[model samples]
Target chain A: MAYSDKVLDHYNNPRNVGSFDKSDPRVGTGMVGAPECGDVMKLQVKVNQETGIIEDAKFKTFGCGSAIASSSLATEWLRGKTVDQALEIKNTDIVNELSLPPVKIHCSVLAEDAIKAAITDYKKKQGVLTPEAVAVH
Target chain B: MPPLPRDYYGFFGFDRKLAIDSAALQKRFYELSRQWHPDRFGRKSAEEQEMALEATSILNDGYRTLKDPVKRAEYLLTQDGFPIAEQRGKDVPPELLEEVFELNMMLEEVKSGDESARPQLEQSRQHFLGLREGVDRELLREFQRHDESVEASPTSKQALQEIRGLLNRRRYIENLIRDVERALNPVTPSRPAPG
Candidate 1:
């Protein structure tokens, strides 16, 4: 299938395709997998300890072009954004940006999930209560 | 020929379970194949010939899916309205995430031509293979459990759901194994740049 120009561009030149030190208390790493397709994605966010801003983001994905593109776009959107703002990023936005076909929509979902998992990890390390935890009260 | 059953097990006249008798399935497949073989319908009416072709197609698809345990589980799961292949839900076991993370790192190293990573990749491959076998055994037991439960009962659904989760884990591990294989043996040789 012909990928959208944006998808192809991201696949060919994926931004921030690397990893950070997971042991660093400032860096939160999220690893997620789509069992259906056996696609694994790891997204990490380096947060500013005091300001709670995400200084940088990196991702590594093992799957199809759409998956690579989704996570690539995710990291680009993550950098310099606060963790709260990053959570606002949605799969639909990624899907629309990549112009992913119906079958490839799950790739965007995985990307969005990776972002949430990463942010959750970051929040957990700081011992700060997350909204979900706050919601339980 | 009457319309073949849509489900693979129904088409093959076998019970939907993980522990299928391979020999019996093979024998039944051959019998059905011969019965539906288009060549036997050479002198039949055009409509009869078309029916035979359709029946043969269904038979071929059923046999292919039913012969493999993994595919068979996936088929049963789809029939149960839990199509894992298309679902975006994160159903993997939480404990596996750590192992998957480390495995991915090793895979990256191997891809980068770090020969030192080969040993760890091999170890991971072996570990995942063992895990796959355990899943297969677990599936067999779960299949029997479901088959014994009253049809359409909550017990049956529970068993089916458990099988779906196992299959999801199996698929992820299978993918990791494939990546390890690819890294261990690089398929494409490096090509010289054009002058």
Candidate 2:
């Protein structure tokens, strides 16, 4: 399937394609994989604790171009967004932005999952209770 | 030739079970192939001839699918409502992903002309191969457990679920092994250039 020019662009010159210090308390790291395709993606975000905004985002992915582009685009959109705003970033939004075909929609979904995972990891580090954690109580 | 069973197991006239005698399956396949050879229907009516062709197609496809243990288990999983489709990230254990990510990083380093990581990759390849052997052994036991259980019983369903999880892990490790081997050998790109 032909990738959208946008996907190709991001794939060729993936933005924020690196990682943050995993041990940093302010850094939230998410590592996720798609077993069917054997794709692994690691996305990280550094939050400005006082301002409650994401100051930086990075990603490293080992998979198809669509997956690499999806996470690349995710990091681009993540910076400057508040943690809550970032949570609102949906997989469909990524799909629409990337013009991903039906078969490649899971790539965008993986990116979205990585975002939530990173945020959750950061929250856990902060000892903040997530909604799911609260619901369990 | 009342429309042969759509399912592979049904097409082969085998009971719905995971543990099958390979020798028996091969014998049955040959018998069916001869029965639906199409030449036998040379003087038959047009519809009967068509049915023979259809059965021949199904038999060939079904035999190929059922001949391999992994393929057979995958087919049974889908038949039993465990499609083994894309697993959600939550379904995968985090530590496995972490390991996969690290191995991938090492592979990239090696691909970029650094041979320093070669020894480590070789070690990892052996580790992953060992992991795959363990998964295969467990899968064998699970197949037996599944076949011994009553069809549609809770035990059968549970076994199927466990098989699905095991298959996912196996697939992950298989990919890692393939990647490590490729990195160590430095062949053509692991994936075709993306379009």
Candidate 3:
């Protein structure tokens, strides 16, 4: 199937693809997998404790082009934002941004989930979740 | 949980337990597929062909569900009780829904920003893993007791319901983690993408 231009762009040139230290206090990591498909995804966000801004983001994934594109889009959205803003970023936004098909929506959903997992971890480590955050990370 | 036909275990010709013989299961599936598969009845009458297809589909479904423990548990729970699809009316605990939503959001974040919250992602994995492990253990215990009973009990009923919810929730979280891992760690991204 011919993916939308946005998906092709991200798939062909995925961004912010790497890993980070799991022990870092400033970082929150979410590693997940789809056993049904034998796919794995890892997402990370470096939160600025003082401001709760996501100073940086990264991911390492093992699946298809849609999965790659989704993760790529997630990292691109993560940089230069408060964690709260990052939290607001939705899989629907990524799907719209990438123009992904219905079947590939899970890939987009997956990327969005990783960001939240990472942010949640960061908040959990901070020892207190702000009332505004709901601390679901 | 995946839906399985009644008497699925009987079709597979095995005792109900986590310790299923993989090789036997595969061999039986392939053989059944060869025997009952619609492809073999392509030249037959329409009624015969339809029967062949139905049989093969049932065989495939049963074997697939029995092939994996997580799936098996989920299938058993679903079989024992109500379909989770109908549980939408009830209020699920916030903790359960929260993790599922966040796991999805992180998948989007890490895709664009590499190595941003890698640590946090791992932490989430650990947390979910812990939760899943506990749930899994609980399921095993329930199943064991269920095996010993002459008939189902109220406790088993409740446990299976909870198991169904956990399994469905886990499946969602699992999908997100896979998307991130596949995107960033593709030494080989050559496989077919998910639909």
Candidate 4:
């Protein structure tokens, strides 16, 4: 299927494609995969502890073009946003921005999941108790 | 005809169990083929001929799907309300995902002309193949569990759930193996010239 120009652009020149030290207290790492398609995406965010803002974001995704573009766009949207704002980022937004076809909507969903996972990791590292963490406990 | 017997097992006159006898299934397939062959209904009413055509279609599709163990299990899963394709990443264990991600990175390296990583990629292929074999063995055991339990009972449902997880892992390993093989032999013809 032909990808939208935006997806192609991001895919050809993925932004913030790398990783952060998972062990760093200020860094949150989210690793997600789609076993159906054998796609793995790792997204990370480094937060400014005092400001509660995400100072930087990075990602490495191994999958189709849509998946790469989704994660790349996710990282771009993540930087400069506060943790709360980042949490507000939705899969639908990614889908719309990338103009992903129905079948590729899962790629956007994976990106949104990666974003939430990264924030959760950051929260846990900061000892912030979220309902999800409490539920897990 | 006759609503296509509801499912492949019923079409083949077998119980809803995973332990199918291939010989018997093959015999039944031939019987059904003869019974539904459109040619036999040439002189029948148009409606009967239409019904025969539909039955033949289902018979062919069902036989192909049920003949393979993996495909049979997947079909049963969907019939049992466990849609395999709709399962998400959370269905997979975290450790497995980590290992898959690392392997994918290595594969990318090998594909990008880093010949130094070829040996490691070969090792990874063997490791994944071993994993795939282990999964196959586990599937066989689970199939027994599924076949032994009363249909739709709690035990049967639990067995189906276990089978689904194994199938997911197996598919992931299968994809990795295919990728490794392709990367290892990028230029080799898919079918070597007759030797």
Q: DockQ order of candidates, best first?
A: 4, 2, 1, 3
List chain A TM-scores, every candidate, in order: 0.95, 0.95, 0.90, 0.95
Error of 2 at B92 (Å): 2.0
Candidate 4's residue-wise lDDT over B1-195, tens digit each?
Answer: 345575777777777778788898899999999998888999999999998988888888888988889999999999999989878878767787888888888888987888888998899899999999999999999999999989999999999999999999899889999999999999987986686
Docking class of 1: acceptable
lDDT of 2 at B154: 97
State the lDDT of candidate 4 residue by residue for A7-121, as single tens digits.
Answer: 9999999999999999999998989989899999999999999999999999999999999999999999999999889888999999998899999999999998889888888
Tell me the interface RMSD of every candidate, in Å: 2.0, 0.9, 9.0, 0.8
| Candidate 3: segments with Cα more than 4 A from true spot | A131-137, B1-75, B81-141, B148-153, B158-195
Q: Go through the candidates in order and give each one's C-alpha lDDT.
A: 0.86, 0.90, 0.71, 0.90
Second chain TM-score for model 1: 0.89
Residue lDDT tens for model 2, A1-137: 89999999999999999989999999999898999899999999999999879999999999999999999999999999998798889999999998999999999989988998898888889899578733321
How well does each candidate superpose onto the true structure, as a TM-score?
A: 0.84, 0.90, 0.54, 0.89
Residue B68 of candidate 4: its Cα lDDT?
Answer: 87
- Selected candidate, larger TM-score, 2 vs 4: 2
> What TM value does model 2 have?
0.90
> Candidate 1's fnat?
0.59
- How would the candidate models be sorted by lDDT, starting from the highest? 4, 2, 1, 3
- In candidate 3, what are the lDDT values of residues A1-137, reduced to their tens digit? 88888778887888998878878999888765443344457888888888878888998776778888999889988998997788899889988888888977877777776787778777778876676655443
For model 4, what is the alpha-carbon lDDT of residue A69? 99
Model 4 clashing-pair count:
0
**lDDT of predicted model 2:** 0.90
- DockQ of prediction 1: 0.49
lDDT of 2 by residue, B42-99 (tens): 9999999999999999998898889888888999999878988845655678888988
> Which candidate leads in DockQ?
4
Worst 10 residues of 3 chain A by lDDT: A31-40
